[model samples]
Target: MAKELEAGFTGSPVEKPEGMRKVASDTASAIKREANAVAIGVSDHPQAAGSLVLGIGAAAFGLGYLLGRSSVSTRTRYWR
Candidate 1:
């Protein structure tokens, strides 16, 4: 046990161990901010769901219009 203690004491001195505290605090604060963001997302779940549905509907309508136009063009060109 004495030899182990001596060995442990033989390590180099830290230049600034206090700097580690700042890093720990920064990490903790970032984690807290992310947690708050998740909470806000949960709170807005209903609105998000509605927006997703609206987005999908708009995309489908746009795709359908494009495809219909292409098909019409092909038919007309073939008839000519």
Candidate 2:
């Protein structure tokens, strides 16, 4: 194993396939388009955007609260 490691391995340079490159480019463009659309929608309806953000925040807080409560209860039960 030491001799093999000392010999050192040589490898050819890897090149990205044309089809893969095209697919990656397409995916990037699609993401950009979607982001632009969302920005436009948010700009058009500021109130809706604010509500959406608040709703997401509330949901995240509720999830965290539930998880924390469950973990605390589990710990107490184990200690008992």
Candidate 3:
């Protein structure tokens, strides 16, 4: 495992397949634009974002509370 790891770092860099560069670039740009749009939306509507986060938090807390109070199996002695 150690040898394999060392070889991976020291070995020649791998090359991407033909046309992969263009596809990768397009996908990355699309993701970047979407992320920027989301950021702008969040910034313009801070109240909306806050409400969304609060609602999600409340739901998670309620779920956790119920799970914690659930009656699961108890430990037992098996050895004889």
lDDT of 1: 0.80
Off by more than 4 A, model 3: 1-18, 63-71, 74-80
> Which residue runs does candidate 1 get wrong by more than 4 Å?
1-44, 74-80
* Overall lDDT per candidate, in order of appearance: 0.80, 0.86, 0.85
Task: Point to the candidate with the largest lDDT.
Answer: 2
In Å, residue 18's CA in model 2 sits off its true spot by 2.4
Q: lDDT tens string, model 3, 1-80?
A: 34534434665448753597769978999999999999999999999999999999999999998898785657776998
For residues 1-80, could you state the per-residue lDDT of candidate 1 as single tens digits? 34534445677567644687779978999999999997788677978867888999999999999999887744434454
lDDT of 2 by residue, 1-80 (tens): 34546455587448654798779978999999999999999999999999999999999999999999887744434454
| Candidate 1 C-alpha RMSD relative to the actual structure | 8.9
Listed per candidate, the RMSD to the true structure in angstroms reads: 8.9, 12.0, 11.7
Candidate 2: C-alpha lDDT: 0.86
Question: Which candidate leads in TM-score?
Answer: 2
TM-score of 1: 0.37
Checking candidate 2 for backbone clashes, the offending pairs are none
